[model samples]
Target: DESIDIPYFGELNGIQLVNPIWVKAVPYNVKVVGANNNVVTHLRLWSTEPSKKQLVQDEKYLKMVSKISESLYPDDSTDEGKILRLQQQYLFSSAGIQDAIREHKALGRDIKDLPKYYTFQINDTHPTLIIPELMRILMDEEYMGYDEAWSIVTQVAAYTNHTILAEALEKWNIELFKRLLPRIYQIVEEMDRRFRLFLKGKNLSQDKINHMALIGSHDVRMAHICIYGSFSVNGVAALHTNILKEIELNDFYQIYPEKFNNKTNGVTHRRWLMHINPELVNILDKTVKGNWRKDLSAIKELENFKDDESIQKEIKNMKLAKKRQLIDVIYKDTGVKLDENAIFDIQIKRLHEYKRQSLNIFHVIYLYLRLKKDANFRKTFHPQNFIFGAKAAPSYIMAKYIIEIINRAAQIINNDPETKDLLKVVFVQNYNVTYAEYLFPAADLSEQISTASKEASGTGNMKFMVNGAITIGTMDGANVEIVEYAGIENEIIFGLSAEEVTQAYKANSYNPRKIFDNDKRIQDVFKFIKSLDKDEHYFDFVFNNLLNVDYFFVLADFDAYVEAQSRANKLYQDEKTWWRMSIMNIANAGFFSSDRTIKQYNEEIWHLDTIKL
Candidate 1:
């Protein structure tokens, strides 16, 4: 389809617009059968080939796209790879903006009104090329003046900051920008020159001026470009927003205080609760009045049944049934037999040093040592199954080593007859949303133990809470907000606050070696980990990093985390008390709903209206 008629609000009857051909959007489930005929599924996005004829009406564009597409991308860090990435960014942004302009013209509207009809929310710096691309189109192609183009672009654009990690922030070399996108580069240069002059005119200090520069040290900061070009800028959480203003983007905040705001990230309660836990939904429907599905806040009524023995018994039953489902899943997928009655303590997320799966494994090693050292202790200790699910980036060496250590530890522990029934470890393969549906509803403890001030806002934290899992976390990211909502008593929170962590970094005071040396239990765990039959060379990096780097303060906070885990375990022995706390977690989780987050974005930032279905 070359063009299609869309119902556009106008004095005219019909507006012909470029037709977007919707292709296959389903996820491809590739089943890999092993030697034993056991099957494992790998889910990936379905890909489509570019249509040579349909991509452009002009033969020149078709040839241009084809030629650029043929270029090799070596690695993300290489200069050549960066250049290729910019070329791809320009291709996508230019096409999308051009289509919007073409559609606006088709509706018999002026380009000045583009802001009224269209809004582009750039999720991150990936699509930042759209800023200069839009400016170039208006000035060169549309023959509009620079000031006019700039005004419309700013009016229709917004940016959201997802991560505060320095390495994650995107920057481009000035030479690369000039070579690949000359016209867009010229517009960017102009914007940078104007931004510098604006800061100078305000009588800012030399240091502050340099910090605010769009182009600094021969690199074009994409984040600065985004902040300058967009009408609104926000962080994913309240704490993250404050960090942006107080430190990360302080100069930008000084200039545009109104632009700096917070819209904490949220998870879709529909899939997390309604679809994942239908039995719990049925229980909620019976206990609570009004439509809780449409408006999650109505679920607060569950707090009334928090202490009801019958409701608590039903909650335990629901958890048991979900655990049985997970047991079957683990057996079929990984061939790991699990005790359905054992505590399903889980940590499922992207494997990263900051997220700290290594810390979780270290605690598992500590528990294993305790069981092995004393027979009387092993008999009295509660049975626990530590379940982990994550995939490390291919390039993250330390993270990959952590995954290997987990798997090897699982093999050693599960094979030991003395510990097989008392304590078990299982690392689920190929963790995805499908697996999450089976695991979250069964979780007795949710591991959200990220380093303080590193995690922006974890949507996983909210998902676990909504599904009735008690969070054992530090005061980081949305965990602080979670405790506030669920009540501090309900969650097992430990370690430093964001302020304390920042102060420690400033003073260079944290010493992982001291913690490792002073604690006797830590020594025993380290010895046990060493004695495990594994290749020393493979995990040398993990040992060196923890002993030396300890960048995420894993060792520093180990004792507090262990203590919190003990507290949670002790409560678990009293089934009624634990289920009461679990109910509170669910009842207080309504505020973290995506419905509420979207409404906040609509009202505070986007200013769009809701259309009733």
Candidate 2:
């Protein structure tokens, strides 16, 4: 009966398959439908029969459909086929609203009680249509009028903003919206017109009108709908939320300051730290002598014992044991064996240009060339094993080439006797979630040197920090916050400050070529890249082609990074100091846990408390 109420019955049934746990599915060995001919559809259902005076007077079935539909898609959906999908979204949302109203009535819940029991959390713009959908349910079906339903509807809805990137922002075509949702379009036009009229007598300018208009052009900006419809609108970070208030959605913020808030992102730390490293978790639980699970802040208490040589050795040995487990997996996957004794430097993430695995390679190539070129520079250090695991989004060309270059470089360096002892570079394939658990805890160092302002908030940075590895990262993204939380002496702080980076961009200047010319070490690194004249050449392109275009400010930060890396290599010799830094990093990282972030959100932003599990 509930599925029957949905405008798109088939679509709701599919949603039920994934979402509704009670709906057990029967096996279908048929393979009947042709893949190309068939497509999905969304259903929208309404009581077609005219509402008699008695039906209008009885306020029962009216609000149920409205409430359910609004709850289902309080915002709107954004995908490729805007017209087809918008109709599909509306069908399901409308039926959902209908179902909610019916259930509430059945339970003898009054209109006032609906607000208490029904709280709608609109995830992005995909569900934004719930606004007008509720209005239709209220006014048309129940004869309650528009204004009365909106007040109650807005109170129950909350919105979360996921991305500030313009590409991610959604806008529906005006013609398609009107064609598919004529009644909703009528309400939107009336609302927008009234809004325009509200400001007509005031000193509001054309700029304000252009920015605020809902259905003016094809762009039915979903974020705008989200902000205007809901009582609460939140960004996913302190800095990102600040970006929402101060920059991206400033016009909306100015109109309704109280509505805007920040809820910084949080990972479920249980999966990230505790469950991931059972050996360390067991040690912490046994030695530290308390449950630090809920009160994650209590992990800081472990710092005092970190300096205790016996505990430190035990932790270091546990990391090596994890390394052995990871080595088997790595050898199985990539057919490359690694020594558990060497510096297991790991950089694993999505292969974006901004993340700059190319810079990492350049540094590797630089080290390999120096070992071979410098006659006096004998093998004075433990051989460094550079491990990279990344995947290029099937579309990215340069990223794929970067992968190829790293793989080829590995083959060349791993075989050459002169360079093999000092450095070995390897790119592990198909880096995913399962591999990440093994990769993080085994690392001697975690590379997080993305170009500043490029990475929004790297969850990977926090993972590396709490995993008892020293971070050799730039002062960017969460790395800035990580350095602040960990202290500068505990972690390497290289590259330009946020301010310097901004100023350089503001000046309309930042030359990659100049850095390559002036810095001798940088100059030598590029020269060695060009000097590879082997018949089995790894890189198929000129060295200039690789560094000159320099996608992620690689050449720009080359010297500072090299100098910082030298400091890192030198510090690695003092095992005691390196281990101490690693220990302090893990201890201080308790503050960075998602638990703390969520607590701050409850007190300051959400104004709600957990039921204390």
Candidate 3:
């Protein structure tokens, strides 16, 4: 504890000071229980600790150091917050790298052999700094040459690209980076110089080389550094990987085609299935006896029982019970009573324009309008409850606006007697892992309707799929693979294909205004949204975004989404068919298990030898 001394940035006498900041390594024992036994793994959490002398004399230093471990992903709305975020990233990377090297040296292994024994998987752009940090240790600390350290660093690290959004790929301003981390910035600058020389040797055009450069005019591209420094680069889903190669990171792919690969995302059935939905687990136990918990592939046997009436009845009853559980929670939390018998259509993810929470709510408005005006339509329609759970980032204005609109819409629809019985909207407050445990099992229709090629791969989609929720989604992210596994007919798939969405963006041919003008239903929904816009401008942002600059194609996909919703409602009316489809979804979800994902990673990327306990 407090064993690592890191050079930290501060200001004294109106001048920058690079002083030693002591850090503590807090250890946690994580027990992984197996069938016969359990293994203990140590997780080291790094925390900043001021020296005893500094603690008594320098309150500013104490405050500065304490901020590092106080919270995660702090509000980066101010300059202070932005610097703290970068500091947090570097703290984690530097401390972890130092610890790893120390452990290897303690084991009497040569520093050059680090790659043979260990590998670092950079989850996303957040940890890309690990590349430079590792290089710094190898070259500066171990006194290795530039070529030797670069070779070892590349061999030891791999990157996983999690987003197609350019903003998600982090870029730090060069001045701020150098100020916060002077030595690390020097290493990064050197890395950039060598990489530029390497790129030029390949006979690349100046424009292309500049585009791929790690350091741009004003900032350092973290993702570009990750790609250049890592041995392998992967995407989380099949479509996501293809997008990375053919479009997003095409230049990098052109240079190193062998580096690109796909490892589709997955969820643990132990948690999503067995742990959450015990009733469904019991039904599976009775119908198909196998070690499905240990081996999710055994769940595929449930396909044979899809047509069994007794099995279907058990599944239906289990789903109804889960819905009732969710209804109670909704009533307790929001004072909103829901019809447990109504189709439980749920969309719960981070609130974002690209994720299309607006599209989902717009459909709700359309349905509300239809229920009020058309008696004949109301007579034929089935009752449904729309549930949404999400939290927007503090700095994201539009996302916060979407949240406000959803809550306001929930207030209006849930209070009105005319549509209250047939249609109910509930936005669960403070949604998190606990809320998801309740939502996933209760969902009858899972909404995975992100815009095509926008979502990388949604683990929530996998969670819902395994819990027997039929998906109503666009062909994006893991929804593509989910449809392949669960059978396309079972899912109500809609909207533009990823290729079409990409092409429309490239050609600038698609217009949300055109779609808004062409369709009366979309017009009716927008009118409803406009009606809600008061002095607060709660719905004004939504109206302008959807009509004027719908980058995620919410308006473009509106008609297809509604059609898919109708198809889902019609299928819900047919109980036997719906249950059979639900069973099939559960049966096929075995493919998307975390077991398979990890196995693929170990085989293709990490290649670490297993040690038996």
Best by TM-score: 3
- Per-residue lDDT tens digits for candidate 2, residues 451-489, read 765555667778887878888887766676677867888
**Superposed model 3: Cα runs more than 4 Å off:** 10-36, 52-57, 536-538
Judging by lDDT against the true structure, name the best candidate.
Answer: 3
Sliding window of 10 residues with minimal summed lDDT for model 2: 18-27
| Candidate 2 global CA lDDT score | 0.68
How much lDDT does each candidate structure score?
0.80, 0.68, 0.87
Ordered list by TM-score, greatest first: 3, 1, 2
Candidate scoring better on TM-score of 2 and 3: 3
Candidate 3 clashing pairs, residues 3+ apart or interchain: none
lDDT of 3 by residue, 365-429 (tens): 99999999999989988999999999888899998877777778778888888989999998898
> Candidate 1: which stretches are off by over 4 Å?
1-75, 531-537
Cα deviation at 69, candidate 3, in Å, is 1.5
All candidates: CA RMSD in angstroms?
A: 8.4, 10.4, 2.5
Residues 1-613, candidate 1: write the lDDT tens digits. Answer: 3221111111211211223221111123466542223545453322222443243336653443454345432245566567556765665566567766877998999888898787787887877878987887788778889899899899988999988887667888887776565556668889989988999999998788887788887888889989999999999888888888897788889899989889998887888999999889988999989678888999999999999999998888988989999999999998888888888899999999999898888888888877877898776677889999998765677787788778888888888886788788989989999999999999999999998888889888998899899999988888888899889989999877778878888999888888888998777766666666555455556777787778888888889988987788788888988999999999999999998998898888778765533
Alpha-carbon TM-score of each model against the true structure: 0.87, 0.75, 0.96
